[model samples]
Target chain A: MDLDSQEQILKLSELHGPSQLMVIIGAPDPEAAEITAETVVQGDPSYAGVLAGAQLGLDVYHVLDESISSEVPPEVWDAQIGVMGDVLEADALVAAVAGMRQPGSDSS
Target chain B: MLEGRYVIALGERDGISGPAIAACAEAAGAKVVFVATECFV
Candidate 1:
């Protein structure tokens, strides 16, 4: 994640607490999604930005994740994400980020 | 389930994009605090 984005997330976490915050990622691939999810939930794995070693433990989800997509209306999902969902590795992308949320998930 | 939740949307510039994700989150009643469309590669 960029430094500015990390800063914003940190500020928001401080202001509202991590429990009230959710980070939604829409990266096209599984690897990218996992990395982004890690940055928010665990810390910045790359250790190159403000999130480095900062374990915010924030709630994170992929846009295509069933838990999140299911909450969105069908028509709105179709309009916003359905196109890329058809082309991308939707299942993998969803699982990759979902794995980050659980302790024993096997996304690898 | 997202009702009244605060959201930070990070989207791929080439795929979903930030604004699009933000719109979807809003539809689900999330209060989006930030949106950033970035290149992952």
Candidate 2:
């Protein structure tokens, strides 16, 4: 996550608590998705931003995740995200972030 | 199933951009508080 985004997340967490906030990631690849998920749940792995060592443990999900996609309107999904689904490894991206959400999973 | 939730959208510039993710969140009735699209690599 970028510094600004990390800061915003920190502020939001402080203001509302981690349980009250959710993060949606739209990364194209599994690696990117995992990294962002790690940032919100375990803290920034790169240790270069405000989220470094934060360990907010906030709920995070990929935009393509079934739970999220199922809720999105088909028309909006087709218009804003349909094309990317054809070009990216949607399953891997979903699993990468999903792994981070599981308790005691060796994502780190 | 994100109705009444607070959301922060982070997306890759080349794929699902921040605004696009924000739209999806809004469609689900989540209140999107921030959006940032950046290059991952």
Candidate 3:
């Protein structure tokens, strides 16, 4: 049984890893997200690294843009991979702020 | 022909909108720029 799965995965590093702070106004689409991920898989195998079993924080951002909810669909990616549901930068900032208020007070 | 981030600026006005995207895409040298009316995303 020779599956030869090597050619299956794909990569999109150029499209991936934009400045994390990038703020765009676009719609959310899970199906489109999967299509894009699949495109990466078929186009470049290393795309697995960009978005594997779980899509990285960056992948989530690209699949949709909710900053302009009034103008775009609120839940184009409502279910599926669940990428649109999470926002990492907000979490990181919350953690950073909480760390500042911690007892040890590592940095001022 | 191009690389790095590209910003596409267009006036919301209709008359100038027709050729706006093409001009920007060419100037930026992107292979393609996905565009569709997003009356709903």
What DockQ does every candidate get?
A: 0.59, 0.60, 0.05
Per-residue C-alpha lDDT of model 2 across residues A39-96, encoded as one tens digit per residue: 9999999999988998888888889888898888899889889878878888998899
Candidate 1: where is the Cα deviation over 4 Å?
A102-108
C-alpha lDDT of residue A93 in model 2: 89
Worst 10 residues of 1 chain B by lDDT: B32-41
Q: Candidate 3 at residue A53, lDDT?
A: 41
Local accuracy of candidate 2 as per-residue lDDT tens digits, B1-41: 57888888998897789999999989988899889999845
Clashing pairs in 2: none
Which 10 successive residues of model 3 chain A have the least lDDT summed?
A1-10
Error of 1 at B20 (Å): 0.7
Off by over 4 Å in 2: A103-108
Candidate with top TM-score is 2
Per-residue lDDT of model 1, residues B1-41, tens digit only: 57888999999897689999999999999999999989746
* Candidate 1 RMSD to the correct structure: 3.6
What's the best-to-worst order under TM-score? 2, 1, 3
**Model 3 CAPRI rating:** incorrect
Provide the TM-score of the second chain in candidate 2. 0.86
| Candidate 3 wrong stretches, greater than 4 Å | A1-15, A20-108, B1-19, B39-41
